[model samples]
Target chain A: MSLARLSRSQQSNRLPELLVPAALGTLMLIYFAVPFVAFLTRAGTTNIITGLSTPEAQVAIRNSLLTAPISTLIATAFGVPLAYVLARASFVGKRLVEALVILPLIVPPVVGGAMILTAVGRFTPIGSAAATLGISLTDSLIGVILAQTFVAAPFVIITARAGFGAIDERLEQASRSLGYGPLSTFWNVSLPLARGAIIAGIILTFARAIGEFGATMMVAYNPRTMPTRIWVDFIAGGMDAIVPVALALLGITLAVLTAVQRFGRVPTVIDR
Target chain B: MILELKQLTHRYGDELAVDDVSFELEEGELLALLGPSGCGKTTIVQAIAGHVQPTAGRVVLRNRDVTEASPEDRHVGIVFQQPTLYPHMTVSENVAYGLTARGVEPNQRDERVSEYLELVDLTEQWDAYPSELSGGQQRRVEVARALAPQPDVLLLDEPLSALDRQLRERLRKEIARIQTETGVTTLFVTHDQQEAMALADRLIVMNDGRVSGSGTPRALYGSPPTPFVASFLGRSNTFPATVVAQQPPTLRVGTHKLTVSNQELSVSAGTSVTCHIRPDGLSVIAPGSENGTALSLAGEVVTVTDVGRRYDVTIRTERSDEFVVETVERPPEPGEEITLELPRDRITIFETHDHDRGSTTGVPEH
Candidate 1:
């Protein structure tokens, strides 16, 4: 039989086999799409614009805008090196280190915040020292940052680790043999090769940090983030007040995602 | 000597990978490490490149001990088996990487990159990434990259084995030309005997982690010191034989007797020895042809394989010993009885207990 005819006949024979999965997949897609559609329709542009004009909403927007990027920067600056080490080096307790890196992701965000508090609470030595230096570790922007970093840093580390792991070690070896030192080889070969994945991880970290709620609430409730503000709005004024702030939060997140998608085209080494 | 590995040994945990391997490369000499897969040839290359620290022994370059030095400090250029051209870099950038790392002026680096790219005939591909090139083209880029640094010694770890037969042959010639033009001391590692023999000035045959033999390609091919070298180097018909006479130097292969040169027969009479004869060494004597000083064996044609450029005829003798004979002329069919002639000088004999034997019959796949 001709190839086209054979393929068509085979596809037709498999249609019944695909029916269940296709139906299930479409249902799940709709389930995910429904909330976004409902939120967008209910929180009209006028409501969103008006809600975002409120003093509380403005403060929350300012706090989120300021903290998330800083948190993302911190995560990328520290996490990429950790990821590289985990991927390339073998040392004692390496498995434990890897598991610890993923601990923030595994634990509940409130529990993570509580763990952060127990370690650096006002009564603790680090918190008391910071307080004595006139810097409060909790109930401030620093607290918000700590919470967001705790909740979101794992995304970048895990993704960047996977990216570094995919690189051929021989490429680095080749770099070294060509007279580049280990550090130079890492900068010249490893970093550029894993840039695609690291950028992807950065995007995910920023998204998660911006949307972080439970941990942010547990650590710093006064200097409100978008999620915390939404929670307060839901408690005080119900759905009507919550919609605009929620839409504002969604709008900022979507804008960030869109901007990143447009600009940060992840460059990867072409597979041989 | 440009580079010397003295009694180099490396072990991966409890398993030994390279065992007391020692060799030297004279200035601008092309040496090939020929061996089978997992024979630790690549490990030796790594040791020389300073990528792997040898468990014991020193690597001396230009009379300077460099065994403890890092790869970057060694200034040894290497082309890996896989074309490890930095996929993220353009051809020009890849070629200039080493020079840039060495802090050469940008203008000088560009000049050297263009020079080496042109040497590999990839000047037109300077702007292209490695992924845009063919396998052979990528390998050429790797060679250009390795050569642009002007390293004291160049190590190629089976650089062309990944290509097809036609491309491999073409690149092999190009590599030889490039090496000659650069005049850099080079060590080429390969499992294919043909590639080794065709490219190298001298060959080091390795087996299981040790050097079985080392000599000029022609010398190694004609007179391998060990049975592993004989079977691994080229096509050979090896027979388990016993030395029957000392003065005339004769071996008894089953019921047939074959005489060899006295130079290779160091064992005494009645000692067990392995007889090795290349396919081309044995000939089919026509029924009425004169067999002057050539040992003759009467056998039946078992199989004839028409390999390109020649025909390999497998003949089973009356004593059930099989020997393959290669000839340009068409051979008789299977079951046809024939008389095969063995020239005395073409035979090489080794004491059976001297070294471990590889395959006793049939050609090894490359």
Candidate 2:
């Protein structure tokens, strides 16, 4: 054979080594993309607009939009401090605390709902105390928030802890040496350096909270969220009934992700 | 004294890291704590900065016992080994951080920041982020940031150890000039002896958690109290010898005899001792041109290395002992025999069994 044809034959012989991984990666990408593409194409824009105008769909949308952000705010305000403590301090039973923080991530969502019920059911001490104050703990919006918080709070804590852990301790020490105390140093140096991770954690927490269903079903089913409303519509009218809410959910999540990604692109501490 | 560390001892678990180390720095003086890595030079700096509380001792700054004080309360400025500029802030903002923490007004903080940036000659890069600057520029910003607060003292921990040789040399001169111009009482910690000798007004040599010697560069290099100090501070050749006589202080090294001055001899007759001679202290003499008072030996040239301004000529003497002589004169070729002269006043003798013997053999060739 000529030299060019001989090299081309050699290249053909070696192509399978590279082809296997490429083919497998394409298969996985198609598997993930096919469902979204099918759903969008099947549910036309006219059908989506009609399904979204119903009163039931409107209530579920309002409840989800309202409760998810409140739950996220609550998780962030408390979870960030806990993550900072876990990252920076050493004490007795610290491993136990860390395991407790990660328990929700490991346990099934329905089991976590049951665990929350055992601690705050209507018959329990805390639930009864709230009942005396004219607040029902179960079958209410508060119950929905409780369920969402239980399943979604861990994302923020774990991601933020990793962020705080990556900061160089010497930078904090430099701040302290320059006449700033620990608390001020945290506000000035530690928090700003860890902003990117914290924002990522917040996004993940909100996404998980809004999509939560199993735990919300176990606790509060009356004040329906988008996921619960979709379930109801599926049972009542099959695939045709649920398509519009699913599309709406996908649209909301995409918008939030895009907005946060734009805002969160500010340079992190170690980007350089 | 601007700062004093008394009986500073620290233990990490059961292992002692710093043992009864004590030193004092005068006002506006730059004192270098010099030693190899893991020798507790850094522990002393941490103790002084209040980052580390000694297991036992007092860290006194400006006559106040700061051992019990928090780092922020101590009002000390520190430049860590890394530049450690806040990556999120601009160069001026990083320099103004301390003043802001202390609640300095915006106008004054800006003025002070500019002044320090000017001092480090980084005024042109005031708005640049640390990542945009060169490594040397980043380090200069760190210096400016530490100095802007105008704390009572400044501590630099191996500030130039991470740079290349040319950059390090330039920064060394820059730091010396900065210390002189600002007159800040500074404690500099370093492992490189040349850096210590070049920048320190006075340096304390540490080895294995204790002070081996402490004095001016000239005093310590001229008369190192221990063999470790002798080798660590500069290049030297050591010979195992015994004092043969006390009158005129004679020493016998193998089969060769040498005489030293009375002031140089501390031990009596027949005491085992180590003799230290700097390479530059020895010179090659022509045949029949020897000075009568200086000790002389005949040796074969082993290697002649031209070190730019001078030649380092290695010689193997009749006793089979090797010595390196630095001279500007033309060097003899390998295997050529020549006579080397050792001046009496240049020899420093240490008792062989001194309590603080270090790991250095004081032989540069090996």
Candidate 3:
């Protein structure tokens, strides 16, 4: 037989073994792609232009852009130290704290929002105390931030912790022996060594904040961030109104996620 | 004392890691803490570095009590076994780290970095990252980094232990030269007896979390006080013997009268004492030469192997004692008659009553 025919027969013989996994993998890919492609095709450049002019679409996109980053900043402030502790410290109750940290990631977003409202809603003790201090979480931007941060903070903490954990402790000790105090060593050695992981964590936090929908809806429906605004428009205009907003959300998030993936990859400064 | 570890004691959980280890180092002295692994030599070094706080002791450097001082506050430069160079930084950056931490001006930092890089013979590797350098070059960078700080005291924690034989020898010599040039008081800890002997002006031999012996390396090699020190420092032949005579200048072992040259120590006659004779102290005499062989014993040649430039000839004596002799000329063939002459002057006598000397009949403790 000719070589080409022999190779073709051999490939055909191997195809039976690969068919199950290939079919399953293709099914998954199609499931993931159908909605995204549909949104893109339905919401053309013309549709986006017209959608941007509408007051609801304009307000909601701006609202999501503004609120998501604020939530990311808040998560960073709380998660950085928590990541360090998780990465470095050995203490009692560490596993419990770890379980608590991972809890928000596993719990349904709606439930996480409900839990936040129960703890800090308008009628709750903390909510009343916050009201006295000119802080209203429920039905406000603060409420939206609280919801987003609750869902997003864990992403930063876990990623940053892994980064810090990979660092060699001897380097820190070397810094200390070289005349840098504990905090200075943290700034000079620990932070710089783990900056990649921390940045990656921050990127994940930002993405999670922007995508947060159920939690945002449960707590701050009036503030109508991008996801909630899309839901409201869908209720009024069905799939016709929903496509443009979905596409807008998908476009911005895809852009940021792409940037985040590139930014989050730990740079190889030493090797090449 | 330029640096003093006074009664330093440390415990890891319930187990004692270092026990009442005390030593004083003069200015510019290079002292080595030498021991086998898990012998607490590292514990003593870390205790002095303030990495591990001793349960009961004082660490005084330059007459200042620094038991409570943090490692950074102690102003001690340390080179670890792993060569802990920051992989993210360039060689020059690693060398400049200490000065930068102390907020040295950029101009002086550059000068000091160049000077130390030159000292370690890595002037060309300054711009290269640690991952790009060879292992030996990385270690040199670590050495330069430690020396750049110019701290009051320097600590080398098995710095050359992880290296190959050639690199270890080179760095050992380099460390000695650098310490002399900088005149920095240093504590070099190592498990290798040869390394300690080559680099240390003074050596502290440790075992089981306690000081087994301490002295100049030559003195320790020639006359290690305990069986532990004798074997740890050199290949000394130690055996249990009853002191037949204890004259100021005479020590008779078995039927042969061995002359004691030092004439300072006088142990009691008839007392049980362990006799140690260093291998180098034993001279090989040609048969029928008439020159005195003080405590001579005839034996059969076991083996003779050439090592480097010299031949290591092993002779199994009539008394079953083995001497690893380093000689220039070719030695007798195996199974041939031979005589090893243990000189009169080179011997250590220690009296012991412990039952740990389990092999009581002509016992040689390990």
Enumerate the candidates' DockQ scores in order: 0.78, 0.73, 0.59
Better of 1 and 2 by DockQ: 1
Top-lDDT candidate index: 2
Q: Tens-digit lDDT track for model 3 on B261-310?
A: 66344567777677777665766666565366477767777988877676
- TM-score on alpha carbons, each prediction: 0.92, 0.90, 0.85
In what order do the candidates fall by TM-score, top score first?
1, 2, 3
Tens digits of per-residue lDDT, candidate 2, B199-243, equal: 999989998899999999999999888888988887777767899
Score candidate 1 by TM-score against the native.
0.92
* Winner of 1 and 2 under lDDT: 2
TM match of model 2 to true structure? 0.90
Better of 2 and 3 by lDDT: 2
Error of 3 at A121 (Å): 2.3
Which segments of candidate 3 are over 4 A away from where they belong? Answer: A1-46, A234-240, A257-272, B87-89, B121-128, B245-272, B283-293, B301-328, B353-366
On DockQ, the candidate that comes out on top is 1
Q: Give the 10-residue window scoring lowest on summed lDDT in candidate 1 chain A.
A: A263-272
RMSD to native, candidate 3 = 6.1
Give the root-mean-square deviation of each candidate in angstroms: 3.5, 5.1, 6.1
